[model samples]
Every structure is written in C-alpha cells, then in structure tokens.
Target: MSEENTPPLPGYEGMPLAMLRHRIRSLGEEDLHRLMAYEREHAARTGVLEVLTARLDAVRQGAEPSEGDQGFQPEAAPPPAGGSPVGPASAAPASNPPPHGDPAQPARPKGDHRPGGGTRGGR
Candidate 1:
C-alpha cells in the first residue's frame, strides 16, 4: 500500500489490515468471502478490493435474505492495546527536525545582522 493511502494508526491496526488483504489473496475466493463478511462487520477496511469482496458474495449468493450480510455499516475504530507494528505507522519516526524556532520559516535571515536583530533586507 502507498504511504499516502495507509491510514494513520495509533498502533497495530495497519498490519492486520494489510495481512487481511494478503490472506484474502492467498485464500482466493471462498475464504476471502468469509473474511470479507468478518472485516465488514468489524473494521470496515477502506480498500477497493476488500469492499468488492462483500458485494461479489452478495451477487453470487443472490438476495442477501437479510441486511446483516449485505455489507457492513461502518463502525468507529477502537484504540489498539498491543501488537507488533507494521505498514506506514511501522516506519521510523522523524529523526531530523528543522533547526528553526519559528515554525513557518517565512524567509532567510538577512546579513550585516546586529546581535539578535535583522532588518527586512541585509544592510
């Protein structure tokens, strides 16, 4: 998954999402459909193929017979307690911060500067 596409997680949510996908691919269709239902009812992972899996099952099965299996209603994701990290969140944290106190960094400091003071343009 692209870094941009990966949702920010406080912890291990990212890995299971990715692993669920890998398992889906490995399982091919049947197992994928079962997992799709589980994921829909649980995480409601926002992936194209994952979402499609549930729909495909619905179409293939013909008439869900009830809304419970049609697809999942989105639920609020919970805070993770513990697990090994993975995905975008698993990457290293920022090592280098800009050496400027002012966060905006609007312009370069002018030359011919006095102690702790500088004009709009260097004199």
Candidate 2:
C-alpha cells in the first residue's frame, strides 16, 4: 500500500497486540477500516486481524469511539535518563573455595595413621 494508505495510528505496525487493541478503541469506524485494510495487506497477523475485526464489528454495531487520544501511550514511555545505580561499593564480595579440598571436609594428611599402626595384610 502507498504511504497515504498507512494505518491511522502512528507506529501502528510496531505496536504490540495489546497496545493496538487499547489504542484502536479511540478510532472511529473509518479509521478502523483503514487500519484493518493496511494490516491485511501487510502482516495479516492472526491476533491483530482478530482484534481489528472484533473492534470493527463493535463499531459497526454502534460502539462509539472511546475517550482519550490514541497517540497518548503512557506504556511506551522513554527510558530513564541515566546508567544503572550499581557500583563497586554496592557489589557483593568475591568468593573463593578453600585451597585444600572443601571447607566443610578438610583433606587428610600424607599417609594413613591407623589406630594400631599395622600394614594392609596385618604385616
């Protein structure tokens, strides 16, 4: 479709399905038709088509355009104006395992120091 035939809502193509549904409430029947046509000609997504079709049907059955501007999308607000607050001072200390096996169970010394100090075969 030509640029003139674009969907009435700004950033319509990029809008999430939920956002599109809410935003389309402010559109009249004519605007919804344009949007539905544009959507069918382009993406033709199932969910988007369902939303448009349902809204169009509602409008045809005397559902008036809802209050508030379609362009007023508070959900699409700009990102906060600064880097993350994380810093070295706020970070947790590094962790290192004990050099001698596990801390819970220390490694045994060199040779076996058995009770009677006898060799394997009772030598």
Candidate 3:
C-alpha cells in the first residue's frame, strides 16, 4: 500500500508489541477487523497477526476485554532518618571536565590567531 493511503492507528506509533496487543484488547469486532486489515496491508508481521487473531478469537468466545492492565508500579525510596541531605563541609566535589579527547591532556589556552583570515582578507 502507498504511504499516502495508509489509515491512522491512533496511540500505536512507537508502542511495544506487547503494549500494542494489550492496548487493543478492548477493541470491538469492527475496530479489530479494521486493525487486522491495516496490519495485513502494511506490516503483515506474523507475531502481530497471531496476537490480533487470538484476541479476536477470544472476543468471539465471549471473553470480555479487561480494563487497562497495570503492569508495574515502583515504590518510592525513604530519605535518611536524621542526617541532613548535604555532605560535610570539608569534603568538596571536583569540577566537571570538558567533553571529548583525553581528560589527562592539559587544557589549551585561547590564541588571537584567526583561521581562513578575518573578514578583511588574511590580514
């Protein structure tokens, strides 16, 4: 199919295959059919086709799609019990080094020489 004639698949771009499969679980028959058609015409990936086919079959067997699946939730870390967040006064952090090349190399001082001559011919 031509790029210009492709249908819009809202909320699917850049989504992982597992996430896409889960996201489409709630799609009705008509919508699922549309998605299947789109997949067949464009990517035709076997794994994707299998997932869509399985979901469609499940729907046909009267399995109602569940609400959004909450995959993972991370717990927040606790702060230190009593000590202050700041480090001790005597300890100092080193300055950030310049990017690129070796850090051990000495820094180069800026010079007055200009390359390709200044705007007024190589004066």
Q: Which candidate has the highest lDDT of all?
A: 2
Model 2, span 26-76: residue lDDT tens: 999888888888888888899999999999999999999989976667887
Q: Write the per-residue lDDT of candidate 1 for residues 44-76, one digit (tens) a residue.
A: 767834544654665566623222321231343
Better of 1 and 2 by TM-score: 2
Where is model 3 more than 4 Å wrong at Cα? Answer: 1-9, 67-123
Best by TM-score: 2
* Residue 96 accuracy (lDDT) in model 2: 87
Superior candidate under TM-score, 2 versus 3? 2
Regions of candidate 1 where Cα sits further than 4 Å from its true position: 1-20, 48-123
lDDT of each: 0.47, 0.84, 0.67
- TM-score (C-alpha, index-matched) for candidate 2: 0.61
Q: What's the ranking of the predictions by lDDT, best on top?
A: 2, 3, 1
Estimate the TM-score for candidate 1: 0.26
Model 2: CA > 4 A from native: 1-3, 83-123
- Residue pairs in collision within model 1: none
Clashes of each: 0, 0, 0
Candidates in order, TM-scores: namely: 0.26, 0.61, 0.47
Q: List the residue pairs that clash in candidate 3.
A: none
lDDT of 1 at 47: 80
